[model samples]
Target: MWLSPALLLLCLSGSLSLTGPSSVTGTLGGSLSVQCQYEEEYQSYKKYWCRGQNEGTCDNIVETQGEAKEKNGRVSIRDHADRLTFIVTMENLTADDAGSYWCRVRKTWYLGFWSSGTSVQVKVSVSPEKAMMFLSSSSSVHLLLLVFLKLPLFLTLVGAVLWVNRPLKGPGGSQPDKEKPSRSAPSPGKPCPGIQPFRPDRRDLQTLDSRAGGQQSLDSGGT
Candidate 1:
């Protein structure tokens, strides 16, 4: 059985234990650094940072040629042979910088060349101001929704209070008015009616009794 170069690289990568974060989060306009540690056997190999694409392939971004430190534009790499580790730094991050990357070691045997190591997914988040604005807008929307949800209940409670305090009505379906005492006319130059109001009549008593009986009979008939 013979193994192809790509398959051999995959098998080697699975066997090698590289230490680093599986995913990294960064903020826009900020910078981030990651450390990848390899085995002692790969200390003499060239260390590389690459942007991973489909099918286990990557585009090389930067490499350290056994140098202590190297930089390219916004990317910097530091090789530490004593520690068996390499540090990669990316500055002035943006949304477009978010993607999958690999910290790899290049190895060339007698017949083929390949890279093997671990990968990290980098995610660049939105700016702080934009995040805060989104949160503020969401809070305002929730507040308005709460007010709208409670408005009908508030109106119903007010209506119930008004209904409870409404004025009492008479049998004719109209609010009754306070009654004023009646006054009689004065005799010609004799005395005011307020002073000569003591008069008892049998006919008036009879008329009241007849009106009371008539009211009772009408009420019973209606019931």
Candidate 2:
């Protein structure tokens, strides 16, 4: 099919679309991996990982020539010709690492500069780890506050129980001595100081008379 130059470029650009996620997240002091897929025809082309807001002016961090794997400092790029995909990895992520990034294919040269080519924008943010740390610190502070608030009440209850169970004291603050019972009977051969001689009452004399009468009656009946 015959086509104008502008139409031809548009067709070429449309056929070189790159597919990947619009955004990615990584934790501080951690690592992250991104996969960018391209067409099979461009599998042998160079693939690069860059960082900047503008895809046309972004600085390349790591790139793989042909089908080789390349590593530069904390960044690495590996291209898989069989899968028509390139993988970019960043290690030891930090707050400074959170920004706009791009995975691009170097397809052709246009007007003294390499064309922006097919790429996907990836936005990275590092807030999840910070939020987790904040929640943990706040939880610890709350636990400490609860302990501090209840400590005085616990001590007060313990002191009251001890006081209620304490032993009674005497006039001099010493424990009181137990009381002893007095002896009802006097010692052997020792008379009681305030005792008088025993005397028989009317009821005792009546009991003696009744016993003598019963004995006399028994003797008469026997004779």
Top-scoring candidate (lDDT): 2
Which candidate tops TM-score? 2
Candidate 2: clashing residue pairs, number:
0
lDDT of 2 at 95: 88
Scored by CA lDDT, what does every candidate get?
A: 0.76, 0.84
Error of 1 at 161 (Å): 42
Q: Can you give the lDDT of residue 45 in candidate 2?
A: 74
Model 2 bad stretches (over 4 Å): 1-16, 109-116, 128-131, 134-223
How many angstroms is residue 129 displaced in model 1 relative to the true structure, after the best TM-score fit? Answer: 7.0
Candidate 1 residue 36 Cα shift, in angstroms, is: 0.5
TM-score of each: 0.48, 0.60
Quick one: how many clashes does candidate 1 have?
0
lDDT of 1 at 44: 87
Candidate 1, superposed: residue stretches over 4 Å from native = 1-15, 111-223
**Per-residue lDDT of 1-223 in model 2, one digit per residue for the tens?**
7899998887577445678778888888888999989987677778889999998889999889767788999998999989988899888888899999988887776663765467778997765586688899999998887788777788889999999998999898988778867668887877796987578999999999999999999999999
Clashing pairs counted in every model: 0, 0
